[model samples]
Structures are given as C-alpha cells and as structure tokens.
Target: MMKKSFATLTSVLLGSVVVLSACGSGDSSTGTPAPGGTPSGGASGEKVTVTLAGWTSSADEKELLQQTLNEFEKKNPNIKVNYEVIADQYMDVMKTRLIGGNGPDVFYLDAFEAPGLIQTGVVEPLDGYVTADFDTADFEQPLLAAFQTGGKTYGFPKDFSTLAMFYNKKDFKEAGITNPPKTWEELQDAAKKLTKSENGKVVRYGFGAAPEIARQMYMMKAFGGQVSDDKGSATFASPEALKGLQLVTDMHNVEKTSGEPKEVGAGWTGEMFGQGKASIVFEGNWAIPFLQTNYKDLEYGTAELPTVNGKKGTMAFPVAYVMNKDSKQKDASWKLLSYLTGKEGMKTWTSKGFALPTRKSVAAELGYDKDPLRAAIVAGASYATPWVDKATLPTIMNNFNNQFIEAYSGKAKLEDAMKKAQDTANKEISAAK
Candidate 1:
C-alpha cells in the first residue's frame, strides 16, 4: 500500500488568522481574561481559541479530532481549538513561518525533522508544564525518549510507527510455505523459493528492495550496528553495518528474488507487496490502514520483522506535538497540547488504526494489545531503533540513499557504497560541528 505522505506546513499558514478571544468577565487567578470572554456566574461566558497545525488527509481522522475538540470545549468552556489541515508540503511552509516568528502555537513534529527544528531554538521545553499527575509513565520508553534532549522535554509523542514484515498470504500458499520466516536465513530461503519466472520473463518477485535510508537503518540495527556513537559521529562504515547493506544487495543481485524500487514502478516497498508482485515487504504499521483501504482484495497478514542472525530489531519512528517557543499564547497552546496527547485524545486518535499510540495505557484502551497487527507494532517498539542521527542526518541520508540505490541495482558493490556514504557523512558532520 502507498502510505500517505505528510504535507509541508508553509502553504497552510500563509492566509491563516491568529484567533484571540476573552473567556469571562471576572479576572482569573492569573489576572488574565479567561480566554474568549468574561466569566459569568462561575460559568465561562466566552471561549479561548488556539491554533494547531497538522498533516491529516483523512476526513474520518479530521472528523474524529473535531469531535474530540468539541468534547474538550464542552468540558473546559474557556478553551476552543482552531485546527488547521495542512495537506502536503507542510514542512516547507512551516519552516518559513517559524523563521518569520509567526506560526502555529502548536504543530506536528516528525522524528526525521525534530532534531533539526529543536536545534534551531524554535521549540519550547515542556518540563515546566508536566506534572506528576500527567502520568508520563503511561508512555512506552522508546517512544517517550524520542523527544528528550539534554535533560529537557521538547515535545510529547502522540503516535508512533514501527517496521514489521507484511506478507501476501496467497503468495505464501502458492509457494507451498505455510509459515512466515522467523530469521534472516529463513527469509532469504523463502524469498528464493517464492520467486518465479517463465521463459526469462519474471512473473513474480519474492521481495521488494526499498533502497531508502529508513529501511536500511532497520537492517543496520539488525546486524548490531549503530548509526552514531556516544560522541555523535557517523559509523555507517562499521563492519556490521556493511554486512546489513550487503544482505539487501545480495537479495537483489545474487539471490535474484527481489526487485528494485524502479523496477517495480511502485515508488515504495509496501505498494509492491500489495500489488502481489512481491511476497514479502518490510513496512511500518501505518501501511495496514492504507492496504485495507486501497487494496481490499489482497490477502495479507503482518508479523514481526524476521530476526537477523537470531537477534531481533526493527525501526521506530514517532511524531510528536511540539509547542512554538515564540507563541503569543503559550499557556493555551500547552493546554491544547496536553489535551491532544492526554489519555482520552490518544485513545480517540489511535482507535481508527491509523497509527499506534505512544502511551502504553492508551494502546491498551484502544485494544491494541489484543489486536495481532497492533500488538506486533507495540512489541517492536522495545527493540526498535531510530533511523535518524542527531547530527548531519539530512546530508548522510542523501549520500547513503543515492549510493545504496546503485548497490540495489547491481551497479556498485555494497562495500564501495558504504565507504562513500561514510566518508561523505563524516565530512558533513565535521563541517556541521
């Protein structure tokens, strides 16, 4: 399935208005007008409006969120939410407004771009807002840790995605395989057997090789390699990392069981699997909803990504709700942020199976623990490693992704690809420092 991409925020904020209103007539404990109007007989006479920006393309999701916002407004009569839908190109638009000192009070922050934004001093730390009653412990460890930096919390994780093996059940049955592969070697063997051709024309491929950096990052961890060391330096040239890259390259060039991204013309690994051209593809949990909605005819099931040499690992990517440091309404922003990531909102947002809640309690409330696919995603969170490096990730990703494509196409050796990537990343990191 083709996963929905996040839109850049630049265009969304161009004509948007900043809303402000009085809450009540009487002064609050803070001596400020409540939000929208004055307090009347202990009842909130007005409303407080706050702006939030996010990339949500699904009408169902938007309706669900609007319902939740209505509930929040009913409970806290003083607060109202103005949620803005930024379709695509969210980052480019958001960055422009952020640099101009005028942007949404709260916005979405993906794992891939969080580091760069945090480094720019535009995001506010949330430590002062969080209290013991907030129940931070409800969140899973890896998910919660993604937004922490230098002993301060920069954002609250809302949802997460973890890599898992998506297999075509019909293809597996056709290949006479009754069970999914549990280890790297078994995966390779299964791929080879499932691959079929007729008269030199390939009819079906066993796997799809997505030469993107994120997919390769999971493989790197499976081989027990780290993208960066304690001092935050590039380590993609490590022997273990090279081995992981070689595994995928070998699958395409040596095993002849996998097709490159270009060859499949799907633009993504999950799409290839959903089309039945590939038997197995490693993709994130978000692919589940996409597949169910788009390719309802495909008989598919998901499992934990097969282990590498008996050592299990996968990639975890989380998107958090971050507050703007320069917002005129910081308190209102925090309140909205708190509500969205709070237990109730978490349940509502993740209940549709669009993404997994970062909070363990929220996952339980959403019954994810009982759902096999969601359970696998939650379980993978513990052993999952992040694909991003704290420094020079964009440059490193560009270098690695371009060179790795060559290896995937049999135009370059894995070792040579890694060597060039490592050198380029190291130079970029050094210059960045």
Candidate 2:
C-alpha cells in the first residue's frame, strides 16, 4: 500500500501510535553525557529514556514493536524506551511538535514524507551514527536511498512493501484462464475473457483499478514518462506518461472490463477482489492479512505485476526510524533507532509478515522469498521504485488524484485532465516556493 498523506490518516485502517514531549537530559548535538554522568555514545551507564513514536495498523503490530523495544532495553540496559501512540493526524502533529522543539527523540517517517521533513533541517543525519557493525549495505538499496539526499542519510527504513497482482483462483478457473497474465497485452486479453455481465450491468469486472497517482506512478514509468522532473515540476501529463495511463482508462471506459472499488460499492481493491466483484487487483502485502482475516474463504495467488512495455515495475512504500535533530538524548535515541532497524530487531519486527524487512539479510533469513504468497513481493524489491520525490509531492499528488479521477470516471480526457492537474500543481509548487 502507498503511504498516505497526513491529512488522510485513519485510525481504523492505518492503525494507531503515540508521541511524547522530550524528557531526560544529555547533549543535544553529540549525545555526550551531562556533567557527572557516564560518557555518551555508548549506552552502558546513566539510564536515559528515548521516546519512540509511530503508527501501527493493529494491536499485533504495536506489540511486535514493543517486543523489539524490550529486546533493545535488555541489550542496552542503560536506555529505556517510552512508546507513544499518535491516534490521528500523525504528520500534522509531528510537524507541529518538531517546530515547537518538543518532538519525540525517535519517530517513524514514511519515505514519501521524508524529503519534505528532511529539508526542514530538524531531522538528524544518521551517517555519522552508523557504525561498521550496523552493516548499512545490508539494507535494500532503493529503500535506503529514499532517506538519503545529497549523500547524507536522514533515516533508516524499517520495512517496505511492493505492489503485486492478486488473482482469485476460482475466478481464473471459472473463466477458463490457466495462469496470471505476464504482460499488459495478455492482461487485456485475460480481462475480456474474465469479465462477467448480467444484462450488461457488469456483475463482475476482470480488473480493479486505482486512479490515484500513488498507484499509477509505475504506469507512468512503463512508457518512459515520469511523474516529476529533476526540479520537482509536474511532467506526468506528457504523451509518454499518458500512453501507459491510457491503458487503464481504456480498460475501464472503452473495454468496460475493469472498474474501481467505488463502481462495485467496495472500499478498496482488496475488498473488491475479495467480494468477487473483480477477479484481479494490484495490491501490497497489507491486503494479505486483510483477506486472511475477513475473507478467509477466498482463494487467491500472488504474482509480480505484469510488465509494461517489456519492463517490470511496481511501487515501494518504505517507512523509517528517524531522530529529531534537537533531541536532548541523542545518544540514547540513536541506540533505539539503530537497534530497531538492525538485523535482530528487524527480523523480529517482520517475522509475522505485517510488513517486509528493509534489510536484505533479514528478508533472506525470514525466507519471505520462498513463502508461497510473498515470493513475488520479495522478487519485486530488486526493481521497485521508491514512492518518494521532492517536498512538493503531496501537493502534486492531491491535484493529480483529483483530476485523474475525472478521467477515470469518463468525465474528462486523460490528457486534458492531466494537463490541468500538472498546471495547477506546478502553480502551487511555484507559489509555495
């Protein structure tokens, strides 16, 4: 699943977490111990509490994180972790607290929001804190790169997920389809055969589509088009981008073989596929647990998304643990941050598969690549695009999604709608600058 904007944070679907004011004492700049306290950087003596804040999608995820923290505490007996849950408006609250200088020592940062927050200079650069023992190279390059800017590291991604095709086995059998499509052309052929209609009312669609920019960015890339240029200006409206996007629009409008969740009165593609309204959907690992819990009887298989223009592509959403530049307990905060993203902690955090580990070692140790349902997802890490860009992405995303929906609904042409979106977004970015 894509990392959503702070404005759209939901307690039910996105999970819950907490934040806290700074507590305890130490040097804010270097993590050196205060006078009469043990030396800093090493967490051997002089107990210090580092506050960690993040949102968990469920109680299990929260507990899993707590277990990791508990292990860190045992290893570094001098440090105590204060876990806080932010119920809603996570980014809004985080930004407010950051500006006020009372933000948590360590917190969760989505890659999509990392660029914007890092540019503010309040995020501590972890390059210095990273040690040889940390094995920085062990992390998947693309995931780690999301938090890097100008060769400086701001955060370490804790976990990530890539989009994969989820197809209902029963639907495939009923449609006389033997396998999932491996290319866009084959996908169209499959869609035509799988579509079921009752008096032209479309009782079932062959594909479920998401019109949001987050989901369509890879589609844009398939044809050598990009969402934004090096300057962070909108470029998705270009002809190359539209060539790939048109496939989706055509599938829904002209071919009439695909539909979004709203068309079937569902909340998301996962639900649309689970309810048998759509035989196939492109979703992330988040949907796996959802179906297992809510649609237990649904028989589905996962596969790497079909290649577009002969190239495989998918969106990767990664979240990291970052330190506040102003934290008084910088040393203790680093301990917590490093431990959580380290091999031992990451293995535990991702053991249950709520999310995929960001570290290559952890993923191989967990054997997710061999797990029947997770293999395709793990295979995508090699080429997945990190869902991130310049700070103006939120604004660009809002405008694009608004207009893209108009095109998806057949109310406007994709080119016209995208041009309007790009113009409006660039104007907003320019005005903000």
Per-residue error at 416 for model 2, in Å? 0.4
Give the alpha carbon lDDT tens digit for every residue of 329-349 in model 1: 556667778888999877877
Q: Count the backbone clashes (under 3 Å) in each candidate.
A: 26, 5
Candidate 1 Cα errors over 4 Å, as ranges: 1-46, 230-232, 431-433
Q: lDDT of candidate 2 vs native?
A: 0.84
**What are the Cα lDDT values of the candidates?**
0.73, 0.84
| TM-score of each prediction | 0.88, 0.94
Worst 10 residues of 2 by lDDT: 1-10
Per-residue error (Å), model 1, residue 54: 1.2
| Model 2 clashing residue pairs (backbone) | 17-85, 17-86, 18-84, 18-85, 18-86
Q: The CA-based lDDT of model 1 is what?
A: 0.73
Error of 2 at 417 (Å): 0.5
The reply for model 2, stretches above 4 Å from the true place, is 1-44
Candidate 2 lDDT by residue in tens digits, 173-225: 98899999999988898999989999869989999988788788888899999
